[model samples]
Target: MRLAWPLVTGTAAMTGSVSVLLAGMAGTAPLAIGLGVALLGCVALLAQPFLGLATLAVFAHLDAVEKTLFGFLPVSAFKLLSGLTVLAILLNGPRLRRNIHDALREPVIVAGVCLVAIGFVSAIFAEDKAMALSSLQKLLSLLLLPFLVVVLADTPRRVALLICVLVATSVASALILGADFALGVQLFAQSDAATTARTVEGVSRSSGGSDYNPTTAASLMLVGVVVALSHAMETRQRRVLLLMAVAIGTGALILSFARSAALSFSVVALLIGWRHRHARFAVPVAGLVLLMMIAALPLIPAEYWQRLSSFFGGAADHTLGRRMTYNIIGLDLFTRNPLLGLGPGNFVHHFTDPEYRHLPGRTMLGRELHNMYLSVLVQYGLIGGAAYFAMLIAAMRHLGAVIRHPASEAMRVQAVALRFGLFAYLLVSLFLPNEYTKYSWLLPGIAAALHRCNRLAWEGA
Candidate 1:
């Protein structure tokens, strides 16, 4: 009876507060509603930090949705969620200190910090201070992602859950893209006309309602496919669901008409098959993938085939030729400033210089360097590039250790999955300048977390 009275009184107080908010801000109902939701989310996150982390993962993939829901406000939804999550973590002082200590010990984390430092240092010398500082701010914001994952995903189960959240969000994104294509709608399309109008041989490419362009979307889906494939191999309990995710993700990858994604997916598949050749599930999985490909082949649009074929057309292909031109330009920039290189985010500014005007395809001004490594080298020079490479290498080494550890099969399987996932990112990075991509940092963070979990398990045993 006492509990009932408290609940009634709490409900009355909440109703009164909400009524006041609505009555006071009748013209801004959406804002009021958003505020209410954010408040509730904050409370929930404080109560369960892991849930907040998972929510962040989901929003990371659904960036377009986040912008739609909260773009009006001065603050970003991601930043708000991150702030709340950090506050939640801070509430537990001992755990936060331990997490910070462990995170600092990670070589990948250290290398990442060094890379960021190099970026900031380069920014200080950048000719376009505003642009460089702006880019650096975004980069710094993204840097929090890895630390959050490392701290919150401390146990094997939590790591797995985070992985599942990633996979699930990827699957959801793929499904949304598929629906958009089938319905001939812009359900999740980028707002920019140039991106939406992209075409190959008279066929329009679908970006599908996300902030990501087709290529970026394909790369993100590829990560999901890799992780899902690994999970499929490790457990029978969710085999069907995982396979469905793989199939849907592959479809989305193909639908995006990204040649690099297709190539990377092929390479990762081959690597996984070779690694698990002797396993009992290997042949069946291979056979299923083969069947899926065969079934999907007839349904593929003709333009997609044309796009894929262009990947091998070399100098004859306009896009490939332009990419080659960009590479040369990037090299020229690197040579001109070989030591510290061009200041951060100054590549686009330099692209307009008269000296580069003689280059073929110089008409396409403001185009980013398509290649990630070249972008880093051109922006931060050899030192920063080395630090970036070191971070990736450290992540790969950590995952390799986890894979070889005497841990549970599931953990080992996830490690292998993440390693291949990172490999996919690296392969895609060859074509796309996604050096500062959240997913890139996220894979390493998860790798570090998994490595820590495996080590702790060993020590406990």
Candidate 2:
């Protein structure tokens, strides 16, 4: 999969750096460690696919880095790793030139750029220009995501590896969450004393931090469920790993007590179950899931249960009421600035404006519309929203085409999972404000990458 010198050189450099750090660099140990990690990561990036995998792994598990000695050192490891990964590809030069061209040509990738351009232009009118620009940066980071995915997961083997990395990371997080569930405490947040814990009813949600708090954690676990389920259906060899992932992921999810996540996970599970109605594994897995559900039934807090049952019983759900109010506010914002809306990230600032004082929302600061679609609609208006929507539609169509006319067995398997993932994320977006996050864009990148594979022979390219 790669040459030997990059590894050898990287190892030697890292070793020599450690030697120096042990001698006279102890005073600047933090800086030394950060530099060493970056160097080593760059070397790993010599193998383009590994760099991408490492980047995604770091992205997925960066929250858990708090367990490390230098976790709280403000190292910006994710940014460093991602930047180095891209740099490494550039260093590959002519070898990767064609791949780079292919990645850029992806419709999803083009659509993402257009979407960002619209947001960038919209930011000029932002009530808080700085905040809108800040949000744009986040969206811009996401735009680079497809290139990374294409370079890393260009082949079937790499795509499988990608899912494996996600599964392993998700399981680790789920285990942490499960431990918290059993001990009734968030041991992971002990380092960040100032980090407020989010709890529903008497249970503490498994929010590692603001980046991956309880809501995000639960939603990610839901994504994990899809990946694991997809791999399980794709192969019979690694049944145990997939089952363990599904089990741990389900446990972690229940603990989060996130209504939207729970509902989304349930819908995906049912859909997958129906899709695999004739498969041999479906029956047993379904039974195990049923058992897990029954066993965990009593563990569900009455408060969460009431929230989940809101639709059936018409219970007065506070969260629902709040989201409704916030959404109405978003509508008003869109109506006023119907062309461009409040700007990319101006919603929170405008939410504080005097004109919206009559709305049901009480607090203005740190306010989110709850619905990502509505958020995009309010901020980017119809044009930007349509561009983003086109991206999603393109991804769905690509995946659908793959399923209908897959180039290979591996392509079919991956397409099935990614198609489900797209729907699952879209469904969860109605509750979770995830439109701007890196996670939202990564799946589409994979879908586009698969589409590219169908056209170009990526398998042994």
Candidate 3:
């Protein structure tokens, strides 16, 4: 923990520098100051919860005089912090270095390397070299993720600390949303005009004027719920903390207005019930949830319901129509470049609306397919897609063992609780696009480590 101080200092310094730069900028910078701040805020929002609230207020008052200055704070912060983090790691080589051979044993590291290789090769022959190179960068950049897995692999207590951070983040976000509802105005807002227009009452999106797309938020909250549940099962003394975590996470997921999250949380809840073997509580809880959902239907703003309802009855402009269009275009792109697909992140350029037979503009009648599987298919091609899917499945199998293994009652239940949260979210992500979720990809690493650790424990026994 003492060694971690320098790394934290470097990270904070970078964040502070970027945040100041963003806040100081005047009119007509390439990066919008407000957008910059909000985006970068995502990085530290977990580390410093109050910062988000501060960003929201600052953004609200920003005008042309300071708009660009503050808009791009988040990006600036991310760039600075990421650079500093890398520098710190390099400077502390002895502390940061790992046995590469040993590290590759983790499934996630292996998958990441494979993906990076595929991306690089695809870039060499890519129809658009720049796009290929960019995708390759993103693929390789995630290498840090596996390091996080390996570091935390042997330390369950550290994992518990991370869970605590997540719980705190969720609670803060929920509190922010609650404040927004009470004020009857969007807070911690971005200038996402699109999100603002579509927003209903009671629930506020993370930022103002931004799309309330809850894919990331929902996924994060679900993970929080899982961690909380896991903690609850592990320690009787922390029951209150665990229960508060569950309530905050569950409440935030609901307030998010993300149907996908709702579905995912439902699955997680069921799994939790089953794991606890509180069979008697299952039916009643389900019934209550159903009642809350139904009661919530009328309570949601009409416009909000209109968007949600469109999912069921289908939206002519969006919902079904948009998904079908994106998939059709994606499939065609996949067919053309089946070997590498269109290069990661290249799909948007290749994507077109079949109905209008044209590329979709921001204001046009088109949007991303609210699905992750389809996005992978379009970006990674069949080969990359297969590798990715296989990796996910393999991780799932490894995680499955965590709960299934014959262990002490408490550990078994803890494993069950943990896996339930992870697996349920994976299943729910089918309908929402969270392809870039750090946790989603990181879970495989965690699972691989867990499997290895479990094996070692058994062998020693």
Local distance difference test values of all predictions, in order: 0.78, 0.72, 0.56
Could you estimate the TM-score for every candidate? 0.91, 0.87, 0.70
Per-residue error (Å), model 3, residue 221 = 2.1
- Between candidates 2 and 3, name the one with more favorable TM-score: 2
Best by lDDT: 1
**lDDT digits (tens) for residues 132-197 of candidate 1:** 887788777777888888888889999988788778877877887788778776676555631565
Q: Where does model 1 exceed 4 Å of error?
A: 1-34, 191-194, 314-317
- Ranking under TM-score, best-scoring first? 1, 2, 3
Give the winner by TM-score. 1
Off by over 4 Å in 3: 1-76, 79-101, 184-186, 189-204, 207-212, 226-237, 274-308, 314-317, 353-367, 406-414, 456-461
Better of 1 and 2 by TM-score: 1
lDDT of 1: 0.78
Task: Give the clash count for each candidate.
Answer: 2, 0, 22
Model 2 lDDT per residue over 124-239, tens place: 88878889989998888778777688766766667666656566767777787777667766665533321344443444466532246577666666776777877677667577
Q: For candidate 3, write residues 97-207 as lDDT tens digits.
A: 553345656666777767667766666665667766775665665555544445334444433343355455555556665565557665554445314533333344542
